[model samples]
Target chain A: MKCPQEFVFAANYLADMARSRSLEFFRGEIGAEVKADTSLVTIADRSVETMMRDAIREWFPDHGIVGEEFPVHNPDAEYQWVLDPIDGTYRFAAGHPQFGTLIALARHRKPILGVIDIPAMDERWSGAHGWPTVHIRQGRRSEVRTRSCTAVKDATVFFCSGIMWRNDPMAVWNGMHGVNRLLDGDSYSYGLLSSGFADVIVDSGMKPWDFMPIVPIIEGAGGRVTDWQGMPLTLDSGIEVVALGDPALLDDVLRRVSAA
Target chain B: MKCPQEFVFAANYLADMARSRSLEFFRGEIGAEVKADTSLVTIADRSVETMMRDAIREWFPDHGIVGEEFPVHNPDAEYQWVLDPIDGTYRFAAGHPQFGTLIALARHRKPILGVIDIPAMDERWSGAHGWPTVHIRQGRRSEVRTRSCTAVKDATVFFCSGIMWRNDPMAVWNGMHGVNRLLDGDSYSYGLLSSGFADVIVDSGMKPWDFMPIVPIIEGAGGRVTDWQGMPLTLDSGIEVVALGDPALLDDVLRRVSAA
Candidate 1:
């Protein structure tokens, strides 16, 4: 957590830019294409990515870029901005407003500043290297801190999507369904976690842009985000990720989801 | 579809009342209790239901009342107002905005007027006999219509909660997961279906209030809501239900989900 205040400010600004552009096409008749990876992609995603990349280059020309809809740019730079213009395209295209624009700044392959903005919902979350995490809605902002979840048996968990169950190792799916309350939440679960409204989230099939911005947000709120194997997330972390509001619940959750 | 305009107007007014009452507690610390059925219940739910019941009794002294939080009133009356003060208590208690207050007026045990009001999101959907289905958001109203789904293989389905899969017949869960795409949504999914944003939603463990209002909304939108066996919904219908935006896909969806 060594990023500067300026970068955090810039990340928030970039997210605002992404939000206005996204709202323009949201809930409208938008066309989409099946990407080479089989994920859904709409012009909205590409348009927002381009808008963000341009702004980042203008603000910090030397910073690298890694985004979901485009090729990585300047990969060797020490500081990088990661973007996911539309994190939940299916929900977005389906006219559900939980889709968000994610922005994260990584230094030396570690995320240091992150912002999660849902324009349709008028909600945003920002966390940085040394800054406290905050959740913003409408015009008000409040600092967010995770609540303690001392027992996996009592913790409420949100599985990002049931599709994740299809992707999760069978044991992981069973363990996730075994939680006290396993709800279905897409990216909205992250914001809930940041606010201490929920305790755990586990999901699979994520890209860097999907997991990067979330790291600082959750970590800033005193939570932990890691691959299911218990490794801290990096630009290269595997997609199967687990986040816990209380670090104490990690061993029990990992053991349950990874049981042989 | 034969309800009078006065009835629809009253339902909408009741919804506005429900919205304001629910918001007073949303995202705020509120106490919750475990009901005899093991479901979460809060003062928010009870307060809204009581408010609606008082208005209904005062407005139509002869009318019946059936709400999730309270016992049935005047069960033998020809006209009954079904209410679910907070349809997704888990989500509402967790600070999620997808929960809704459902109000439906039933005649001869068949629902005729329905309102789904999402208090936190400032969104409401009302459908009534002889009235066009419409979605109202932020003081604006728009007619809602379902889209055609010629094939189940190409349809996007929302399973109300992953918890439903645990409660449903195993074959039903497998059938829902086997759909082309599965997203997690609750009462909000019913609204999505009414708007044609999603094609099918199958859920289990519903009470009269949980499934009643949705029937009019979907039907008015040119969709169909029924038991998993495809029988039309009634005050007496089972807890398991299915809604299809395109009635033509009903056969395929039912056959798949009902397979032994």
Candidate 2:
């Protein structure tokens, strides 16, 4: 499935809208209200989600929505927008500037456009189905592609967070125990993967909004983002997402992290 | 022993000099020459270290020097300077902007003044005996303090990188394997701890220049920094370091990471 150029344009527009709203809360005293899951929610999250949802309603009323805050709107529409207004709220509430606003357009449950906008960092990574992935930082833009490194020992692997790893029932913690070059990071790690700086990224317990935008970015950058079983990511995909800059290392990475 | 106020002033001044020199290389195509230890070395590292050493020679000709890139100067002097021109060269070479220049003043083999200067981020953390720790970013400065959080479950722990945990002969990492709210970061993590935004930073295989500057900053902020064995950090301390915001958690934290 392919997204129209206008879809990518609209997704970035919606992302910019989210960016302006989220920027005001970064490094400031933004209060957080604990959500039902014991995760965090700040005004920036609610405000950005509401603003994006309204924009989608006005521009693409026929499209459905899946977001981290609030509800699912128009669940049966053929095209849908997936959003995670603040991707790393735990860090955001602590005034750390790595949190981001993610936007993606999916057709029939498959993402065709994705945008990861980090307002504080002034960086954005966006991709559409048939075009090269683009990374923008500090007003400069360049096409990006993942590198090809096959050996697991030479590969720099990353986990999403120590918090997620600590509670791993999937035993990924044990699976990755001895990987010498591993790192622990977040959406930023996925950004690095798409840009050839980092070779592999793995994480679990993510939502459709948490993992969808990254699918197009990495895939268009000539990498892979799949579940533990190597299935393509969709709204219905499992919580675990593994991204590799070098497609050749999938078997080696999978052999280690897929089973524990 | 207390260092004269001039020593702290000179340290920050030296850091600024190093910062101005290093800023030009950040995110640019700085050349790297691998060291015999298989770690990275960049022109930024050599240039900044040379500049700092020259400045120290001009200002305190009798002081000793120990730097990452060059040999000791004035080794028999009563006071010495420790410098790590670029502490995170691997990230710097990858165009990741978390690298920084560290400056510390040691008198009688103990650090009395320390500064961590992150040029690209435009952030700096500095501390001297008899004063509060300071964090500077975006042209604003604030006296920072570490918060007290006693329970391991309630604490927010951070690691310098997952790479350190991947090859843990000391096993402090296994002790921290399952605590909640862990962040993957570096010197920035220590700055956050000094600012009361985080607690509990653990890393091993550090050098004098790599770990010394952080000692005064955290201790001046009313926290603690020591080797994993719970010994106060000194020129002779082991490479493993554990920092905690609340002294109450020391026993609990030490029980796990302090031993193999």
Best by TM-score: 1
Question: What TM-score is obtained by chain A of candidate 1?
Answer: 0.91
Off by over 4 Å in 2: A30-44, A148-154, A162-180, A248-252, A255-260, B20-24, B30-44, B148-153, B162-180, B248-252, B255-260
TM-score for every candidate vs. truth?
A: 0.91, 0.85
Q: Which of the numbered candidates is closest to the native, going by highest DockQ?
A: 1
Give residue A143's error in model 2 in angstroms.
2.8
Write one digit per residue (lDDT tens) for candidate 2, span B136-228. Answer: 987999998887686877777776653344454225445665554444557777887788777787776688997889989999999998876
Q: Could you tell me the lDDT of residue A162 within candidate 1?
A: 41
lDDT of 2 by residue, A153-199 (tens): 66666766532434442266556654434445578778877887777
| lDDT by residue for model 1 (A171-226), tens | 45567554546556556788888888788887777888888988999999999988
For model 1, the superposed segments whose C-alpha errors exceed 4 Å read A29-40, A166-179, B31-40, B162-180
Model 1 per-residue lDDT tens digits across residues B1-260: 48999999999999999888888877765422221112335567788889999999999999999988888999999999999998877777667777889989999999898898888888888999888999998888999998877788777777665434553334455675545455565788788789888888877778889889999999999999888798998999987788898999888888876772
* Separate DockQ for every predicted complex: 0.39, 0.28
